[model samples]
Target: MSTSHDAALLKPGFTDAVFEAQAGFRALLDALAYAGRITTLEVSLDPPAPLDPATAAIALTLFDFDTKVWLDAPAAAGPVPAWIRFHCGSPIVSETHDAQFALVADARHLPGLGDFDIGEDRHPDRSSTLVIQVPALTGGSATRWTGPGINGSIEVAIAALPEGFWAQWDDNHALYPQGVDVLFVCGRQVIGLPRGVKVEV
Candidate 1:
């Protein structure tokens, strides 16, 4: 646990915490409800190093005492973890499998989707949700997506992910009702890719 003085050294959470969190939560819901579609998040907060505004906002909105978070190397160091502990009150875990939500600062070096909790057949909703920070939301290799939330087919692009990201995602998609979901964040934008969604590069 971080002391109050340690937390005070980090950047604060949203200015209008309650309202901002509510608005951010709505944006997150909208993103997930329309998988593969990018949604804009507007939350006023200066998060610590390694945490983008969108990721930080999502953390504040979705995480609570009930959730366990896993922070990647960069995010685990410095004041970022302390800030999350102070604002979200979610326990930060060391193992990826132990996390309900995982935050990765760099998508290019992100671990395989299979590394996280995929949940059981009867409780697929308990699977881990990964928040990955990408360079940009658009202008990269395009991938086609089709799933429940998507009406038909939609093309989406994310910049600078590792080489085998799509391959790993393909394997994850094959898991159907038992795989981790993903949220790609860049700047103040966020896009969802639920476990059921199929992606074709």
Candidate 2:
């Protein structure tokens, strides 16, 4: 049996694979450097529905054959997994704990941070990175952000995250170098929230 998402195998990824992936990678780096600052993606893509250009761009730029990806319920039930598998050459894992990256198209249904690998002190870099799709990068309630890349602090109001997510984030941040990092995306805009960042409501 082939599968439902098999059709996604033909869905195109980056228009200019090498150039666009590099550009997208650079954009992500800048987003992380600024931590909560918006960095728009310049890549072109006809990504599967629910996977916006920014989210898809990050996947294409970061995922490789060795990376294992986990999708939220909505994404896994759609063509998202197949698209990632085909273009990124990443294995789609059923469990979040085993994934190097977790694409959360439906953050309202997001799992606890503990569900994914949070890495150990000795291997902090082994933690999972989450790409969460939010409604917008701004125009929601504001929360104060302060951390390594941030000189002072920035107020960010990312819309549509799951209930208790911020509280969960507090515990995650407490893990310091062992917590999962997050990238929030809306349309072509993305904002990185590394684990080292602190958020205050």
Candidate 3:
């Protein structure tokens, strides 16, 4: 038998109901597309330090009984995971490849993007979606973003990203419909990096 979400996360006014959860998910989507932008979100949980607004927003939206989550560092233990389990009912997986969603607390701690599943050619959407919790996302980075959705190119600074993360991503792009998508969270904002996007770092 399984315990209900209501029974697990009983903290008054802390758990996000359905309506608020949708809003959080939307906010995350918008922020990722347009970098350096700060989007305000309604954070219901009182998560500990190092868990920024963007990361918290992501946890609330993506975590559910059907979702499998993986965490690195600071979030590997303590209040962050507990809050996620209590509110979203998402299961935690051991390997990055097995996760439906992977939340990396620190960019520096992130393993190679290829370490996680990039999905097969037929069903590329089955790959893991990475949620990177950045320190501060500001505009004016050297990295240029250009893909299907953007008009020309967009530039933004995603704090602490590894040197090769983008380069490897470019290589992955050649694989076409067989790469992982990504979401970058900072402060209370997020941005989407769909598999189709050609990331030129």
Candidate 4:
């Protein structure tokens, strides 16, 4: 009893489920392991527009039936969420705070970082993870980043993020292990912003 639109929602997923998902997970670890360093997610996926292939790959690798995902307005309008539910079997939640993963198809419409769950002290791993689609990873205003994964400090520029994002990031970073983690994706590239990373705008 599936409509044409519903059928279309089920897009092609990872080319090789096991191997590709592992590669995507490794790429995610590498990105977070080297703060501000751009990592490539090379998995093959044909998700609907506005959902970057890299972001989709990460979704496939990260989400499970037990996970709850929140999609921004623009993302929710598309096939991306349905595709995630189809492949990953994760529940899509209406409330941001209820989500373990939130996907933003348009970075400009992103909600406040604090709107999502930051996790409790006893369960820091319960925090949300944001996968945001940005214009580009470079050619934006440069800011100094320093944290555990960074060698010392690095100059990072991610374009088209909403104004005052870094300021909110400062607040989020203060929460340490309880804060939400982020992966900013554009095309096949992703930049990780772990909760430990500090930004000087």
Candidate 5:
């Protein structure tokens, strides 16, 4: 890891310097408990270009030298990946499964979510986690969500989701604990849908 002044300054003071980052992490956890729910987090400064508020927030929270990232669109070669490298120090990988963090610049271009890692039988949590940066989400999607965090079902209108994504996710649910978790970033809002949650059309 580079320890130069610039790199050291890039290190998030949130773990020690700022309190808002910790708040964002907590809000993120709560949002994931209920699928498709939205939560807004406050950021002290604007993130680099091609980055939304939620994306910047997460880059600060989960990334480090230990993490590997995969980029879906905008090719991870320009300002997008460079920002991640400068701030997070996460390695970029060519393979999706090898990545601990995957950033999708445009949601429409996102691959079938199931094409990514779904974890494993022994250590299911090892699956790749995705960060999908979408254009806009008016009211989330009307995918009836039911599971641990919800009572009965909750309706949310998600942004543009890929074709047959639900069917593949249904298959993934069968795998139980061994599946991927996804985080959606739009502007400064975020929501998480872990594998444990069930989404029905």
Candidate 6:
């Protein structure tokens, strides 16, 4: 009764899950600390289809038994969810609001920032973190970012995001310590956008 999808779900994760996840975790930390700066993930992984290597690596690195994840339609119905379940032991939730992390494989259909969890004033760390996959990490329309991590401002490019992304970000930024943070993945590169950062298109 097993299908090809089931078989794919059984595939091994990173070649060295612990070490690879550790390295990826460090890279992600640096990306977030620097805000708009692009950080490359040099982890070896054989991720399931529809889940890019960078995205997959991040899931493995960040999620644990205590975390809950929400995957987009394409990723949820595929082997990617099962792969994460097997490797990361993170529960996959049906509601975006319940997720600690939301994996958006297609940027075009990304959910509005308000739809996800924006932690309450008493516990701001409860907010969801978005891991969005994009076409390219660089060479698109420029967006100027400024806030805690930058000296003055930094211009970065991210290709193929949903329309009104910046408008939504404006609202998200206004939430201050309660807003969700984002990590954009393209190929092996990742760029972070923390809640405190301001983005001008």
lDDT by candidate, in order shown = 0.90, 0.89, 0.72, 0.90, 0.74, 0.90
Model 5 C-alpha lDDT per residue in residues 96-165, reported as the tens digit of each score: 7787778887776677666778777788878888888876655545678788888787776776777777
Which scores higher on TM-score, 3 or 6?
6
Top TM-score model: 1
Q: Give the TM-score of candidate 3.
A: 0.83
Model 1 CA deviation exceeding 4 Å by range? none
lDDT of 2 by residue, 61-96 (tens): 999999999998888888787788778889899888
Pick by TM-score: 1 or 2, better one: 1
Candidate 6 residue spans exceeding 4 A from truth? 1-9
Model 4 compared with the native: what TM-score? 0.95
**What are the models' TM-scores?**
0.96, 0.94, 0.83, 0.95, 0.86, 0.94
Per-residue lDDT of 134-175 in model 1, one digit per residue for the tens? 989899899999998999999998889889999999999999
TM-score of 6: 0.94
Q: Could you tell me how far off, in angstroms, the CA of residue 77 lies in candidate 3 after the best superposition?
A: 2.9
lDDT score, residue 99, model 2? 91
From the highest TM-score down, the ranking of the candidates is 1, 4, 2, 6, 5, 3
Clashing pairs in 5: 13-17, 140-157, 140-158, 141-156, 141-157, 141-158
Candidate 3's C-alpha runs over 4 A off are 1-16, 31-45
lDDT of each residue in 1-201, candidate 4, tens digit only: 336688665878887899998888899999999979999988667777779888888888999999999999988997777787778889999999999999998999899999999999999989999999998999999999999888889999999999989999999999998899999999899999999999998
Q: By summed lDDT, which 10 consecutive residues of candidate 4 come out lowest? A: 1-10
For residue 147, what is the lDDT in candidate 3? 73
The stretch of ten residues in a row with the least summed lDDT in candidate 1 is 1-10
Clashing pairs in 6: none
